[model samples]
Target chain A: MSLLAKASAAHLAQLMGPLDSPAFDWLRTPETGGVMVRGRMGGAGAPFNLGEITVTRCALTLRAGGAVGHAYVQGRDKTHAQQAALVDALMQTDAAATIRTTVLEPLQKAAKDRNDSRARKAAATKVDFFTMVRGED
Target chain B: MYVAVKGGERAIDNAHAWLAEERRGDLGVAEMSLEQIREQLSLAVNRVMAEGSLYDADLAALAIKQSRGDLIEAIFLIRAYRTTLPRFGASLPVETEEMACDRRISATFKDLPGGQILGPTFDYTHRLLDFKLAAEGQGGAAAEAPASGAPLPHVTEFLNKEGLIQQEVASDETPPDLTREPLEFPANRPLRLQSLTRGDEGFVLSMAYSTQRGYARNHAFVGELRIGRCAVEMEVPELGFAVEIGEIELTECETVNQFQGSKTEPAQFTRGYGLVFGQAERKAISMALVDRALRWEELGEDNVGSPAQDEEFVLSHADNIQATGFLEHIKLPHYVDFQSELELVRKLRAEATEAMSEAAE
Candidate 1:
């Protein structure tokens, strides 16, 4: 999975604690925008625009290692976008291993756990139907 | 002569204030929260999401609250909000074959590969109201079942292999975005399907019902109906490969309809397809029937002149927002037009009376 895909807005918000005040320049300050959502007839059919949704995006370059990181998240949360970008930048440096384990792994686990619990609730409602064979069949 | 009515700004302001008060209802009763609507009234949210063509449950809930549970009004709110967003690049066509299905059923087959998984449907429920739900602290949790493994193959594939069903040809041409552009006449299949998916559910349902009632009748069997979450991927030009963007819940229905062979063709079953955002099986199924009915010209079927078979009629009237706007506009001042009619009647009556007096003299 891509780092961006792994880092959902909620996960990033929870994972990213206070940054160490590392020198970084704003490559692109957080800005609110919209994105057109599209869908196809079937999974692999002709595409059409569903509608547009609000999004926030930001980009930054770490002064020390010159690693650039960008983030785009749903809704108008600028601070969430900035924090996500910061995490992205740190993931490229020597702190990559630490961040992956402490931040990314935990977030992934939490997401998986939530999905599993939901599935379990749904499964409880699943009905397995059986047909009784008539004598003549 | 009629003059335009002057401002009723104060009356309008007072009306709005009264409406706001009415929207809150009895203060003794608990106020409805966005979360409660999102969780408890999820089906309404699903309908709004499907019709609004936007899939955010939270936003749908908010719209419902703001509209005071008037679903059509809620849909309008969502549609207005959706028009302001920007255009990111289109994601690759979603892979429904890999959908983690919650509900899967086939009307044609008794037992098939992946088995029929009826996930969270109200199909077999008794229609009687549950009085238990009204009592406080009477809610009970549903039993949990483990998630099934492997993606279920589509039921139509079996018919496809036998050369019985019409083949769907893959195309790379960019389909038109209905939301971004004005609708054009004689819309192609993609455009028609797009309109039908976001079209008013009740309108589409009635159109589909018309077909079953012998108006442009096409014998249709639900080949497959599946509801699940499908992965949405987008090709990142910089990354040079498509990456998983997100997953969205979808309802897909494929209908197999009987078709007679034309002079140049052989008899084979044709398909009508419907896919929409969220678990909206009724909308999806209705869309498929209406879609097939609208394809009369392409299929070489005679124009029966039925409302369902008329492309212009179905497409034009399907949108609730458009229909409601014109329907509700009757409440607006029409004094100018009414006054003209009133003058014509007066003159005609006077002429008749004058002619009668002359005859008497």
Candidate 2:
């Protein structure tokens, strides 16, 4: 996944906190719309339309470098999509290295930490069984 | 003659007002919080989530409050709200074998890999109502068991090893979504199961019961039933890998039915599967039975013309939202149609009198 794509909405929102708003033109204004969800039978079987879910998508081009970025996020959070698009555009420019270290790295670590904690909690509930050896057998 | 009734706006408004007042039921009592319903009346919230097909406990509780404890009404509210939301993507099929189960049991085996954990169930509870619960400050915390640390194995896997159960071939085809497209007749197993999972609990239970009473009877054994939370993952095409999206509570049931042997195939036990949102064992078990009954054609069994075996009948009427809408629409104005019926009856009566008079003359 692209660095911007890997960053979750929560992480991206936090990353955008200190950065000054860069001038950009809206290639596509953030719009809330429905997307059809499809599911495959047994995960590996024939696919079928599940239902429509709300999504917010936006596209923007950085005024200086003309780096275009697009983002789509689940639910109707328009600001999340806008900020995500900006991050996507920034990732393609000279600021890529700095952004990777400052934003992406921390976000990735947080996500990994969250996953590990959940796994630990679930692991606590795991059980193992063994059969008793029968003397008759 | 039936005349069209008009000017019901005032009456409708007054009725709504009365309902709101009744819902409050004396402002002297404290208003019920959504949190209370979510925590205390959790089973109702679970039922709403299962039938509604939306797994948000808070929203389900809110729906319960808004509907004045009418579960069907709460389910309808959730369904209506669900349609407006956009779907992002489908999650990877949940692995039930990896479930951190709160409840797990199998009738086929006495002791499985993971010992049967009964969890919180009303199975052993006495039918006598606990009047003390009605009084305030009478509630107490129940005992808790230490979490197990062993992974549970499926009972069907044991049969599979001995080549005694039918082999399920994995396919790459997509299943049809009942919510998006208008339901078509002669539906496949995936479509049938999907409908059954979100189907009305009472309706599905009755249909399953009918099968047990010799209507398309497929002697079923509860192979395994598990209720727990599973992680949801989604494939990111851009990233070229699937990532964990979230987790959801689910109830899964697998039933082994009667043996069947065909000309081309050997005799082996058939399987029926059901997976639903929340800890809904009854719904899941019923779903599995109905699922197995509907597999008559593929299993090379005779069509006994049973309601359980009828795919079109079961799928079409299973949804409570659709059933209630059609049932309740009778309250709407039908004067035009009723007037036409009245005119026809009057004309027929007049003709009969004229013919009688002519015969007398």
Candidate 3:
């Protein structure tokens, strides 16, 4: 669910390509609002409101007797929220394994790749003291 | 003292129309898309997000475009828009320890667990203008190496373990929101930190600079500075536990300030913190310094009587939108006030003229 929220809407939509969405009822229609972001003092102390970040959330019930799906995603993309909610509802049904293999697994891999690439880029800038060695070398 | 002086409707409309056309500017040169502004003018967007107290880059970019690149105006737009939206809830205190750091460095230490990653910095670059950027697609992929996934702990933590730095006990007490309540005197650390993080960049920078020049001097060392994305988690009514709703880029700065001690307690390295939206290291560092300066009383230091030390002064004036509103208000019609001043000066001048004639006689 966290990974789903973190995934870019475009990328998620791309990953969900050709998966036919079942008919569902909007339990709670997609709505955009602000969430006050809080941070701890010294990164480990008491909390303080930093600022607000925009979030779009939605809840839907699958008409085919599956569980209710709820999604809270970043930004104001209603379609993204709707898609996420559909995926959540679908995960509760017998289709859980299929959705996991089709959507979640690929997203997890993509996320891992992104994290690896970022870490790799940072590793490049590490100072190898041996490179700057003088007389001893 | 206040009266509506209306009757410039036509002229005002014309001015606005002209301003709109000016914002568009020479249509043939191709209009700047929001995407281009978001990517190219990112610093401007970051500044707006920081000061405006909002974290939507697309909206910030749009505000920049709408304001014709007037950052303060863009901030004002965001703030105004912010008030109209419903606040869903407050997020759990983000654990920056888990940040996927883009750049992390410790100036106090030569090297640490996380080696100094100078990710996309301009620190060593010459100030010469590169004409190539004036054209398109000058940027290329950055160099990369095999991942060395080492834990990057906060530099201050090591000092804490050795009792070399002051240990801050974590608290769960909810801090006051200035946006909801009016700022009161003798503000606490949480409130002060909140105000500083969102304070105007230029104003906070100047305050920080003053401290360096010996006004409420608090010798600050960059204990650790990290910029990266972190997940924002919130517990939903539907979901039993908190789940990540979003990831936001933040610049966190922890500064080791001048050691402080009371008669009862021993002197140890005090700390100041800054966590701001996006990769705004300059703003974050400035915020940290001012934050330390404001902590004089709490840290058992004497009253320095500096502008930065005055919580009321700094927090009240740190918001550029509020400051600019009051500052720019004078440009509007002051007709009645001016008329009274005009009459008083005229009468005084006439009286002086008569006295001069009498003296001459």
Number of the top-ranking candidate, with lDDT as the measure:
3
- The global C-alpha lDDT for each of the candidates, from Candidate 1 onward, is 0.78, 0.76, 0.90
Residue range B1-361, candidate 1, lDDT tens digits: 5586799999999999988888889999999999899999988998998888776788999999988999999999988887765555666677678877777788888677877777788898998887877865565666677776645788878888999977776666677878768899989888898789899999999999999999999999998998887765666454467665456788899998998966645799887888878888998899989998898887788898999999889999999999998999999998898889999999999999999999999
Candidate 1 vs 2: which has more TM-score: 1
- Chain A TM-scores for all candidates read 0.83, 0.85, 0.91
Worst 10 residues of 3 chain B by lDDT: B257-266
List each model's interface RMSD.
2.9, 5.5, 1.0
Predicted candidate 2 versus true structure: per-residue lDDT over A1-137, tens digit per residue: 23343345677788888887789999889876544433333222344333333456678999988998777665456787888788778989988888778777887788666545544444443334568888895
RMSD of each: 2.7, 5.2, 2.0
Ranking by DockQ: 3, 1, 2
What are the models' TM-scores? Answer: 0.91, 0.78, 0.95
Off by over 4 Å in 2: A1-137, B1-6, B137-148, B237-240
Backbone clash pairs in model 1 (N, Cα, C under 3 Å; residues 3+ apart or in different chains), count: 6
- Model 3 off-target regions past 4 Å? A131-137, B135-137, B350-361
Lowest lDDT sum, 10 consecutive residues, model 1 chain A, at A1-10
